[model samples]
Target: MLVPLVIGMSAPSGLEGGELAAVVARGELVWAADQEGGGPHVFPDPDAPQRLTGFEVELAELIAAELGVKARFQQGQWDRLPLLLGHPADCVINGIELLPERRRDYHCSRPYFAYGLQLIARRDGPLDTVETLTAPGPAGRWRVGVLTGSAAELFLRSHPELEVDAIGYDGTIDSLEQVKSGVLDAALMDDCIFNFYADRFAGLRAVGRPFGGGYYTVLTARDTPRLSTAIDEALGRIIADGRLKTLYDRWDLGGRQQILALRDAAEIPVATRRSLRELAIETLPLLLSAAGMTVLLACLSFPLAIFAGLGVALGRLYGPAWLRPLLTGFVEVVRGTPLMLQLYAIFFLLPKVGLALPALVAAVAGLALNYAAYESEIYRAGLKAVPLGQFEAAVALGMTKWQALRHVVVPQAVRLVMPPVTNDFIALFKDTSVCSVITVIELTKRYSVLALSTGRIVELAVITAILYLAMSWPLSLLSRRFETGQEQRP
Candidate 1:
């Protein structure tokens, strides 16, 4: 099975080689960050989308220059960027918060930026203030969005008494868009991020004062003490010499908040490492919960794919001449495009045509439609493999064309396609992970979140792989049994 092949790759490498020395020898400081985080941190220049420009981008270069190396950028998902440390990247320079738990797992550089959670909502919305949000609104629970695995999410989750329905998004921009569209009552994000995106979303306004303040520090692999020390020194140099101030002012972030970066930073103690068993005990529930969502998506989509594929196959093979080419084109188009693009169009672009779907529904529809095209080709071939003589024999018994095709031909075609159809269902379990882009939490997404938070990539990945195998193994056995039964039949 694909699961075993993937599980074999989950073993992580050790940090035996000196991280800082390697970077110096190469004359390059490779830093990882998520450009998708957007704005004052790091993002593509709006005027020149191909060129990335942000304060963090400049900050990375400054630190690299101080260390006598050129800075190179490696893109990764925001939450999972830490996983790239000690391999392709020496340090992570995104707006990663400096938390005690984070310090425990990774070496964090001195503060370059200070941020706090900024609550945002529609102008004059019901949940404009934190007090209103704390109280039960007309909707009973306020639906608030936060970037998943981020400090804002942690802050919101810390207060269980708020009774808010926390929705996790992959990016702050998406959460803002949701607030604008009235899908979310509010969104909480880094104050700098909201400031960066404020003018773009005019209808949304900052709801309450920014809270849960923290410093943004560059993170290095735990083993890279030298590299972390170098980064901290570089940050101190930048702050003392006013280069950090110049960069902040250029990015419109030179405000009272900038003072936090200037002050003597307090050292946060590292957290105690959790044993593998303890981590599994703590995170398994979250992963299993997410797996349930994955199962729900697969179960809801695969049957629709099968039925829709059947219709397309029948239309191409036996329907009117005028419609055959249209069905052919539909299948070709669906198969030609990427599933991600199809999902993006359905979830993000459909709103333009007044057909905005909820994230779960959109994910299921995208998976179903994409798989239907492939299944149609399989069904088409299976239908074509049936002999023309069988239809004539049925007609010789005075059966109508419809009755003959249904009673005589379809059963054989279905049998021919069953093995492949079952295999597709098996694949769907893994494919559901892609739905995370649209913010439908599934196994893979949950693994990334848990791995990032716990710094236990290998352990969580193994567990996640096992969960995926658990899901698809039964289907694999069933498909094999069905194939063997077919082989034995006379």
Candidate 2:
């Protein structure tokens, strides 16, 4: 088996040093961004699906030009961008806030942009400022939305009274959309982002004063002081040359954050290191909720996969001749592609064609469809193992083909396939973690955010492994029991 060299205690990009010279030598500066971080920042160009266009995309190009290297884009989920920096990526620049935890592990550039949180609400909505909503009235409790891991979310999470049902979304667009749809009372995010995205959506208005501001900086690993310096110098040059203002003007983002970036850089606050015990106390409920989501996904997907697999197998084996080829191709096609791509197609692409599904539904459907392909093959093998002679004898005994296969052939085949089927089920259990790409938060996404925020990687990881093990071990034991019983048969 091949093992990844970068796994375990691996340093962040540049932490080993010389990240700047290495990018120049390679003739490419790999900048990581989550295009799903959404528009006005980074997102797909609707006019041209193959192209990407956003304020960040243009800013990256300017930075790369200053450094004399071609800029290359590497996409990662917004929450996972920091973790990706040390791996092949040189840095992350996608509206990443200068959080305290980031400063401890990463060396960040001077603040390129400063932004305050904007309160987004329906036009003529009852809620306004924190004061109006927090006071005793019919509006005392309101459902608000925030982007997960943003300062807005942290602020809301920090306030128990002000955040009655603060809905967390993976991106600014998702949260803002919820507000426009009346699914949420309001949403909060960078004021600049709200001005760019919310205005176009209609029925939503930015109200109340902007609050809880933070700096956006490019993040590099701690090992490369030179790379960190180079990034700061590049940003300084960008600001001095008025190129930064040009980009911001196009995006209509001029504010105190951009002003601070133009003047002397803001003094970044030193990070207060968190203790493991504190992290455990804070993260316990988060992990438990995520584990519940993981279990929910597993329970929901496996049964659907089992039924879908059964149907596809029967179609391949006993259906009409013309339909058999179509079923065969579907099984082959789904199995041939990666599950991640399938989920992306369902969650992101489907909405364009007017088949927008809720996150949970899309996640379950994607997992079930992908697993059904593999499960179909397993069932097919079992059906073949029943032998042609059994079918002939059952027919001779005056049983119709459907009746014979259902009662005798299928029953025997099911026993033959139980061991492999159980193993596939276990594999399916782990794969559910990928559903977070579509914004369905599960155990893995929760662990990542907690690990980055709490800075208790080793402890959280061990507990997470135990959580996964606790889920899978029982199934493994049951699988072994069936295998042993079969072997012991006379």
Instruction: Give the top-scoring candidate (lDDT).
Output: 1
Question: What is the C-alpha lDDT profile of model 2 across 1-490, one tens digit per residue?
Answer: 0012225336445534577788899888888998877878888998997788898898888888888998899998687677676677888988888877778878888888878888888886777665665654364567677777778878887877763666667778867765665556788788878877765878888778888888888987677777778878998898887888877877778643486554755566768876677777789888989999999998999999988998899899999999899999999899889998899788766765667776789899999999888888999999998889999989999999899889889888888888999998889888988887666778877887787677566677777878888999999999998899889974
lDDT score of residue 359 within candidate 2: 74
- What does the lDDT come to for candidate 1? 0.86
Model 1 off-target regions past 4 Å?
Answer: 1-17, 261-266
Residue 331 accuracy (lDDT) in model 1? 95
- Positional deviation of residue 310's Cα in model 2 after best superposition, in angstroms: 1.5
On a 0 to 100 scale, what is the lDDT of residue 63 in model 2? 85
lDDT for residue 437 in candidate 1, whole number 0-100: 81
Give the candidate number with the greatest TM-score.
1
| Collision count for each candidate, in order | 1, 3
lDDT of 1 by residue, 1-490 (tens): 2343235334342344476777889899999999888888888988999999999999999999999999999998888788777666789999899988898888888788888789899987876677777788787889898888899888888898896978888777877887887777899999999888888999989988988778888998877777888889988898888888888888899744596554955777777899888997899999999999999999999999999998899999989999999999999899899898898788777875777788899999999999999999999999898899998999999999888879998888999888999999998888998898888888898888887788777777789889998999999999998899889986
Query: What's the lDDT for residue 12 in model 2?
Result: 48
